[model samples]
Target: MGEFAQILRAWRDRVRPEDVGLAPGLNRRAPGLRREELALITGVSVDYIVRLEQGRAVNPSPQLLTSLTRALRLNDAERDHLFRVAGAAAPSSGLVPRQVTPSAQRMVDRFRNAPVAVAVHTAIYELVLWNPLWAVLFGDPSSQSRLERNVAWQHFAGSLPVTHTPEDDEAYSRDLVGHIRAASGRYPADPDIPRLIDRLVEASPDFARRWKAGTVGELRTSRKTLHTEQVGDVVVDCDTFSGGPGDQTIVVMTAAPGSEDEQKLDLLRVVGLQRLGS
Candidate 1:
């Protein structure tokens, strides 16, 4: 095998199934993540993964590289190496970093059974990583494409089940646009940033107007009501914290202590993903 394929298989063999949320079932043939499991997590076909590992697939796109980087939990250096081997340029310091450190992944894993829902977003608002509670709270984001995973895109152009008052809607829109604008300035080298802006400008008149007005604001703690089929309507306090490189934002959703919303969240946690799927 070529150097790229050899290292890819080595990395795949080193990562345990449980590390990526898969159950460590009894009597497995391979020691680490199987080809199918990697395909499932990275949203690439199993055939493609096999081809990649065999050095048959060449010139993987940057998006595919990003997916694999996240799926294999590659650190910054490893991520850059993956890019170099794949004949792609690694994101520079000026670009938004999408690499999720092992520590951050552990942090998210810690909240797997917690009542609080957590999700990690890139500088440009792309939803990169999230916990099971996050999936239970806000439908599973794994099925969404890279562009569809963006928070700003969902609010402006996609049908996200968020209910807000007129005032709250106005403020939230401004905050999202402001953050996107700031990210654009910070990560000008990231092509996705400008493409996202252009798509939003074309698809969302509200976003276009705000962008034209140059409304720059900070993300603030806000209350939002989410309508879920299992839990009905639940209100949550949405809080964001700066995390890792690339201006990644760690968002936590919690309900007021002892409130009905809290009770609902607890119920959702107990119900879990299997029940939600059923």
Candidate 2:
């Protein structure tokens, strides 16, 4: 095997199945991730993984490499090493990073059973790393495309079926655009932000209008109404906590304790798990 292939094999061997949210089955000989498991988590085909590991696929794109880095749970130094071995450029500093830090991952894991929905989002508002309650409250964000996973894209693109007052909806739309503007300003050279902004401008007239308005705002705690198919309208408080150089935000959704909304949320949790299992 070539140097790149060798390095890839070593990294794959270092990642435990449980580390990436998989159960280690009985009769398994490998200590780390199987190639199939790695491919599943990375959103690539098993055949592609095999070709890459055999040195037949030498030039993986930066995006593919980034996804592999996350699936393998590589640290900064290791991620850079992966890039170097792949003959690709290491991700530049100050880019809108999608990789959730180990600390941030642990933070979300701690809230596994909390009676609230929690998720981590990139500065560009890409949804990454969400708890099960978040799936219950917001539907399955995992099914969304990379751009569709973005909150701004969801609102402006009219993909998410959210219910709000006309005035509040307009305000929320403006706030989302403004937040994206702020993120763009903070990370001017991030390649993905420009493409996303350009696409949003082309796809939605509302987004085009708001982008020209140039409003700026930070995401703060607020109460919003969510409409679900299983339940009717659920009102919850939305809170955002920011971390990392990329300005990733941890979003938490909660209803008042002992309130009817909280009861509905509890029911939703059970329903969500059932849907996942089925």
Candidate 3:
């Protein structure tokens, strides 16, 4: 096997199933995660994982490597090593990194039992980290394609089924466009930002119009309503905390204490987990 394949196999064997919120299933031959499990957590296809482990897939993108690093719970040194072995450069300091930092991952884990739904998104609003509650409130982001995962893209492309008044919707659209414009300025060298802008401009007339308008803004605390399959209209307060290399925003959604919305949120947790498990 090549260096990339060998290292991947070693790391996969080192990681335990329970370490990444997975159960140790019956009649297992190995103690660590299965290739399928790794593929699932890393958001890649099983065939792709097989090809990667067999050294057929060479030079995986930084984004794909970052996902694998997080899924395997690799430390900083290991992550860099994996990049090197895969014939890719390690993400440099001061540039916008697609990978969520260990500290940020820990923070996300800490809110596991909290009622709030928390998620981290890139400056361009691409989701990178999310809690179970976030999945419960807003469908699982894993189901979305890489391009469809961005908030701005979904909003302009009309993929997200958010329920809001016309005024609120208009304001939200403006905010999304402004945020992307700000991200483009902050990370001028990021190729993904420019590519995303070009694609949106080509595919979405509304997005093209907004881009030309050039109104830069930050996504801040606001109140909005969401329409879910299991639950009806649920109004909640949304807040954004910015950090990380790419100015990633940690979005937290919460309802007022002792309100009806909180009750619905509680029910959503149970129903959502059940749906996910199935």
Candidate 4:
């Protein structure tokens, strides 16, 4: 089978069998849920999912595709890809997996000051664009691996250096990782996703632990504490937006209680000017 078809089959085949509360019977041979059980969760016949993986059926109805996504516990990126294949389009051939639309890129550029990042709808938030504001907030040096750039990896590893206060850092980290984890359930199969996944699972014990939980979440606004080294501890209101197509997202961050971070942001223009002068 081609890489695309193989990736789909492998995604369907692996599941946190325990995550679904299935028995870990001695007879079980695989690491994930059984195909029949998946049918039960998604409310589709297991045989049908089998057909899609086997390349026996193309152009599955949208409704049926949706049902399979629910059943397979697919994430946003995976769901969009499933829709494409089901709709009879060939999978994209980029060496790295991305589905960013021009509209989404424009949105990222528009938020020049806001730390904006657009990701695919799947568990692995595929990266398309990240602005200077994001680089500043995350302490992201110029070099980051294609996989490390994904939000999911950053959230779990806490490897990205964002200037948050001590009191707020843990809470902020937890919510970010949890939300990304929840988002993954929307798409299960997009080629180019699993490579980084395998690498991450091997490199980080924390990520490997959480990944198996199969938690699902929708992007929503909420209050959280963030600690900026320059501003001390402050509350921030975070809002997330769903994309028009391809399940992209826009996240905007603002300082709450009019924190000092706001002052720093207001002064950013001067910094830009001084750098230009020098």
TM-score for every candidate vs. truth? Answer: 0.81, 0.79, 0.76, 0.49
For residues 124-217, what per-residue lDDT tens digits would candidate 1 score against the true structure?
8889889887887667787879889999999999988788878888888898899988888777787888899999999999999999999876
Please write out the lDDT profile of model 3 over residues 1-278, one tens digit for every residue.
89889888888988887667677899999988899999998878999989998989988998888888987777778888999988889987545567776656766776666677888888789998888889877677878776877888778875665666788778888888998888888788878888999999998999999899998987767788878777788888988887554467888888999998988888887776677779
Candidate 2 local lDDT, 1-278, one digit each (tens): 99889888998998788777677888888798999999987889999999999999978998899888877777888888899989998877878877777667766766665678888999888998898878876678778788878888888885665566687677778878888999899899888999999999999998999899898986766778878777788888888886563468888888999998888888887777777768
lDDT of 4 at 270: 43
lDDT for 56 in candidate 4 is 79
Predicted candidate 4 versus true structure: per-residue lDDT over 46-133, tens digit per residue: 8875776677766667556555554455665776776675654433433222444445544555565442322233334545455455
Against the hidden true structure, what lDDT does model 1 obtain? 0.85
lDDT of each: 0.85, 0.83, 0.82, 0.54
RMSD of each: 3.2, 3.4, 4.1, 18.4
What's the distance in Å from true for residue 212, model 1?
Answer: 3.4
Candidate 4: list runs displaced more than 4 Å: 1-99, 113-123, 139-142, 163-187, 222-235, 257-259, 269-278
* Cand. 4 Cα-lDDT: 0.54
TM-score of 3: 0.76
Model 2's lDDT to the true fold? 0.83
Q: Give each model's clash number.
A: 0, 0, 0, 20
